[model samples]
Target chain A: MTLPLLQVRDLKVHFQVRAGGIFFANYLPLKAVDGLSFDLAAGETLGIVGESGCGKSTLGRAILQLLPATSGSVAWLGKDLTALDRAELKAHRRHMQIVFQDPLASLDPRMTAGDIIAEPLRNYETGLSSAAIKARVREMMEQVGLLPSMVNRYPHEFSGGQCQRIGIARAMILKPKLVVCDEPVSALDVSIRAQVINLLMDFQRALNISMLFISHDLSVVRHISRRVMVLYLGKVMELADRDAIYGAPRHPYTQALISAVPIPDPEKERAKPRVLVAGDLPSPLDPPSGCVFRTRCPKATNICALTVPVLESAGVGHEVACHHWRD
Target chain B: MSASVLDLKNLSVRFATPEGEVAAVSELSLSVGKGECLGIVGESGSGKSQTFLAAMGLLARNGRAVGEAIFGGINLAAADENTLNRLRGNKLAMIFQDPMTSLTPHMKVGHQLTEVLVRHRNLKFPAARDRAIAMLRRVQISEPERRFEMYPHELSGGLRQRVMIAMALMCGPELIIADEPTTALDVTVQAQILDLIRRAKEELGTAVILITHDLGVVAGMADRVGVMYAGRIVELGEVHQIFNAPQHPYTKGLLACTPRLDDATASALVTIPGQPPDLQQLPTGCAYHPRCGNVMERCRAAAPPLMSTGGGGLKACFLENFGSVQAGTVVP
Candidate 1:
């Protein structure tokens, strides 16, 4: 079988945060990403679904090597990225790019849209003429549904949607094989969200790019992803094909998440059974023993509290990390 | 329909900017019956929040509100500061999107909760504290006694929102205006918050005005919905009618554009072309005409008034039989 374009094996990102007052302050390892393993085939979209503080964003950054992983490996094109030095990692960055959540904040306020998009080309292709870069930037502007005339406009001059287009243009200008989209459309208006999603999908199709789509919105994830991974407090609760994860979620966390999404249709929304899991997400610094999700999980037993549940094969291409998933 | 707890009659809000006067809300008219939830859905700068802000007399320095927002026979638009101050915490309450910013950071959460009761309900500090803690428990906040002493920063986002709800519920206000209450929250936490709001309406018979951009939240919580665009209500109808048989092109486009959890066909999400109109310089005629799929010459020439749709719905569209023409074409 052909090697996957991106392979993440037992990836963990732990941060040392200080606890207590200044005098008696002690450090604690915040397990943002404990252990996550996944493989992305060429041009495949792997959607990571989770709530805030679930470490989905940390996993995305760790994979991109933007944030250094505490341990484990992220292999891109059969080459280990963790071992790469700064200069070596920079050489491989052109093949991978990230689209941030906040559109306006991500773009440099001082830089014009044209300059922002052209910076990538200027960095990689030092020999390219200024005119050539301008022409390519303009082309990308049109591709991302931005007006070519607005290339000279500052990020503030553009609306939220237009600013996001500029951000997309900048990311896709490198023709990256893999893109880590971290809640790309969360900041956009509802009417503008679809436009951005469509633009990403089109680019993914035309360029045959693998995408690590990270979002808390399950509906948007279900739309874009072929495979889905559900995360809770830095651990994978379930991972499977989009249909299997959404249609027949085995893990109780996945089931609750799916049920929590309010359907737009009033009739169907009222009819659907709600699995409202009680309480907020537990702190990752001091996570519960054994299964991390047992505090809020409905099916928690003595065994769940005593021993951690490893991801086991539930069905073809499906893995669940729950002791009582079968029940 | 039951008696309206809050009635807005031809309300309009305008802000004087350096560039020009921006019409934030234009001649909007709607009413929320006692114990009923009315949702106002719109994109940014669509004046959904401003509509309620105008009613609450909470407009900024340069902003001016016209027409009448009658709440319990008091014209809120014309109400004096002293009169409004008396009515605000006692009869009317507002829950903002960000509880962190909305709530006073320096004060204890319990003080914030008790302040409403002490000022409006004329309860002593000890008695108000008791009621505040009880309200916290009622909203399903665990360890209510311990949580009461904690400051806002000590609480999580969901807990802060729950505290906001508890504060709103302290005086048993007649109307609760929740503007994007669950926008900052995660989906799982959002469900719990929405459920709490639902309970307040059902149990206390409190009129609720849920203002949000999320149609999914509106579908579950709102009894009726008002689709706002370019500072005007494009469509206003029952949640079922609005979803099942949308009469306006804008409503149809919005419903189509939003991604659905149930729909997993791997098809492209339909998008409404063009950006939302600038409030300062709105397009001639229908503000949505520039992006409308079925735009006609008349739509560009003159705006259509919000007319009744025979099925107890109001639509501001000139198109005849929109549901029939757009049938079997929308992505399910």
Candidate 2:
């Protein structure tokens, strides 16, 4: 069997946050990502979904090495990324790229669309001639539905949808093996979101690239990803195939999260039974013992507070970390 | 319908920007009934928010509103600042997207809620404080007595929104305009807040104008639905009619694009071809014709007015059968 394209094990990212003021300052470790493990095969999309402050974004950043992991290993193509030196990591960065949530903020304001798309190529592929880079930029622009005539236009001149198209062009210009899409369509208007989403899927099909899509929007994540992972308070609650997770989510938190999403059908939405989880997410600084989600979880028991549950396979391609999961 | 609480006629809002005058809202005529919820759904630059902003006299310095917004038998559109000041928070309340900015960070939440009652309802300090605590409890914020003394920063986002709702209800306004009230919240919290809004409507009988881009949100709450595009109401009908039999092509396109959680099919989402129109330089004819699926020659030559479609709804389209074909079924 070919080794999985990317493998992550026991990933943890902790930040030392300073608490209190002046003379009575104390340092507290905030575990942004605690013990997350997953594997992504080539041409697959793994979606990470959670509510605010649930550490989905932190996990994405750790995998990219944008932020240092306090422990655990991320192996890319048989090489452990955590142990890599600066020179080695720099060379490996060519195979990975990221697309941020805010398209306008992520792209450079001063740089024209042409130059923005060419910047990545110029950095990674120094051997390529300027003419070759320009040609590739033009081709990428066309692929993302941007006219070559608009290549010289600044981001400000383009609409939000156009700017996102430009952002996609830049991200795909390098032809990277993996791309981390961090809520790419969340900032866009409703009508324009589908356009950008389809553009991403089209690129995935053509390039056969792997993707780690991190989003709070459950519907979008389900639409794009093959597998979905649920996170709460820096811990994985459930991970399963897209259909299995959406159709038969095992963890209580996952069930509540999925049911809470408002469906478009009025008759169905009005009639559907909602599993409304009580209260907001507890602060990550003082997460509940055992199960991180027990504080707000509806099915909290003494055993849940005493003993932490570990991730175990319940079925084929379905894993959950809850002692009381029925399915 | 129940006695009209707020009636608007031919309302238009324009802003004098460097790129010339932008008509944000053009000739909008609508009314909200007592104890009814009117949802205005649109994408960015479709002028959903600007319509309510104009009605509230909250437009920017460069912005000007013309025409009439008849609230409680008074012409709010032509009302002076002094007249609007009396009715702004007392008779008509507005809830914004960000609760933190809408709230006063310096003042305790109890003081904030009591101040509205004292100013609008002319209640004594002690009585106002008691009523404010009751309002907080009504919004389901536990420990209202203790929470009353807490500042806005002390409460979580969901709690802050509850406080905002309490403040809005303090005056017992006849109409409440909530502009993306749950947009900043988590999904679970959003559900809670939306339930709170429904309770407010059911118990208090206060009319609501819910402005949001999420069709799912409108599906659950709205009684009457209005689809806006380029500062114009393209379709207006009952919520059920709008969802089940959307007449306008734009509305159909929007419904098609929104991925449904109930839908088990794994097909790619349907996308409208072009970007949302620029408010400054709208297309000559139909603002949506450029991106519309069933574009016709008449759609390019002339703008379609909001004509009664005989299907218990109004549709602005030149096509004979605008939404006869279901949208998003064929993803090209």
Candidate 3:
């Protein structure tokens, strides 16, 4: 009976790259987001997994309209975000927020933590008093496990994990319904990475915030997401529940990815047969036609090259873009 | 014993700063056996790299190396450039984290590989070229002869890394120290590289000192594991002993932090609080005391020496033995 929190239909984000800089003027479109579609339910976390340059990050930014959407529509709640004016998009910014991959770059060094959290609320709510804004900043910090004393501290004073917490506080300050978390813990040390992961989970549960968590780390994705979508060369390779995806991944690439994760067990390491993916990922600019993964897919057949495979159910609630599935 | 290819006994590495001497590696003793792959597992600033650098005589000009370093029965701790040069590369070599920086961009890939052989082994052009191309194939790079002509820029990240390994392994060194060799590589490439390193070690019977943060890689690659934290070897033992039952708190925390392939969800990552202590301003007692949850009264004032646990692995924690096989602190 309830509508999906976010709906994306045939989203395609392509960049026109001039062959020899701007002077050559030869326009060649880079297929960064070649036909991609997935839905995020309210309070549900959808994990996007892929290697770098797979357009996973681009997909997140495109959904936020942080970058220009070359084609397709992204409807959030009831509003068609793709059709909104610049002013209207800014008005809706508070509802859909993003936590960036790099905490250092995302946060301003000149501004204190309190000011960074207050900036979002002030832009959205003009009638609020200064004292009320400070009170709310303190409240958000406490909600995210930060002491009230840390409010006035500079970004540099905080560790990578703490700076990330500040980033979280800023994202949650406005009470956004949906948040796009882009590799939130990649920069952190392993010990600190876990703490930040826990913090994010606690914040998500408290707010019931829907999120599009994009990361190269599969383990992190498996922990946070209910539904997992595997991306390869700017296209969705497989989509299913997290358990089905991590437990019994149908795609060969997903299987390879799952196997590649180093388990800290000596016996497991020696016993496991590593699925080695030979050769480099194909450049997005010259992505192979038909199935995007055909170049690297071990199961690639003639049908895989002749036509594109649509997202069809290979199993119950499991959609895979491969003709090779179930064969 | 193979006479212990390389040994760093009571080795201490420090950098002279405007403030004072900051000890990066303190009273550390380590040795690699011939053909044995000893993994140095630690978070950053664990003095993993510093120990190898101090042993290999590769410390920067500003850095100082102290204590005993006997490689091939030769004292290298006090060796001059000429003395170190007499043994560098041909007998002992190292591969670093970044591959692109290791190989010269101006030279062709083959030229770079051949130059190392020529410089270290004093081989002629023709002999070096043939051996270099052979080394390329040994590292599993396809079209070795053709890739030989290609410049570093033309190759991929994986290829550049392979070239770095090939260069290091060419002269049949008795010991190879790889500092996070595959950190920059992708998972598939990382696995390939790991397999390649193992094969190379088996073929050459060369001892390998591998330093890495990824426990999975360490588990898969290492025969013996040494966990370094705050410039000390907090835990050291056979791979099975360390993985099955990590005695040190730092080691246990690291294993828990790794996202398990079988963990139900990806979100429940274990987090150790605070950062590694500033090397110069470390706690008086245990370096890990501040972040330690099982902090004992003695741990607050007196640093626990690296003591052998009742079990197979050695530990430096005051608690003696603790921690379950739980994946992490909490399950989400």
Model 2 chain B: weakest 10-residue lDDT segment is: B323-332
Interface RMSD of each: 1.6, 1.1, 2.1
Q: Between candidates 1 and 3, which one is better according to TM-score?
A: 1
Report the lDDT tens digits of candidate 3 across residue range B1-332: 45678788999999999899899999988777778999998878889998888887899877898899999778788898887886777788889999888788899988888876788778999999999899999898889999999999888888888988898888888888899998888777787788888888888888899999888888888889999998999999989988887877778778877777766744456666677888878998999888876777898899888777877667787784475422335534
lDDT of 2 by residue, A37-138 (tens): 999999999999999998899988898899999999999988999999999999999889888998889889999999999998988899999899888988
For model 3, what is the C-alpha lDDT against the true structure? 0.85
Write candidate 3's Cα lDDT for A20-59 as tens digits.
Answer: 6666577789988888887889899999999877889999
Who is ahead in DockQ, 1 or 2? 1
Task: List candidate 1 segments past 4 Å from native.
Answer: B324-332
Kindly give the stretch of ten consecutive residues in candidate 3 chain A with the minimal lDDT sum: A18-27
lDDT of 1 at B120: 90
Q: What are the per-residue Cα lDDT tens digits for candidate 2 across B1-332?
A: 58999888999999999989999999999889999999999998889999999999999999999999999888887889989989977889999999999999999999998987788789999999999999898999889999999999989999999999998888888999999999999999999999999989999999999999999999999999999999999999999999988888888889999877777766778877778887877898898888877777888889998889897778788777653644533445
Error in Å for residue B115 of model 3:
1.0
Number of the predicted model whose DockQ against the real structure is largest: 1
lDDT of 2 at B56: 94
Which should have the higher TM-score, number 2 or number 3?
2
* Candidate 1 structure quality by residue, lDDT tens digits, A1-327: 999998899999999999876888799999999999989999999999999999999999999998999999999889999999989998999999999999999999999999999999999989999999989998999899888999889999999999889999999998999999999999999889988998999999999999999999999999999999999999999999999999999999999999999989999998888889999988878899999999999999999999999999999999999999999
Give each prediction's DockQ, rounded to 2 decimals.
0.76, 0.75, 0.66
lDDT of model 1 at position A106: 99
Estimate candidate 2's alpha-carbon lDDT, on a 0 to 1 scale.
Answer: 0.89
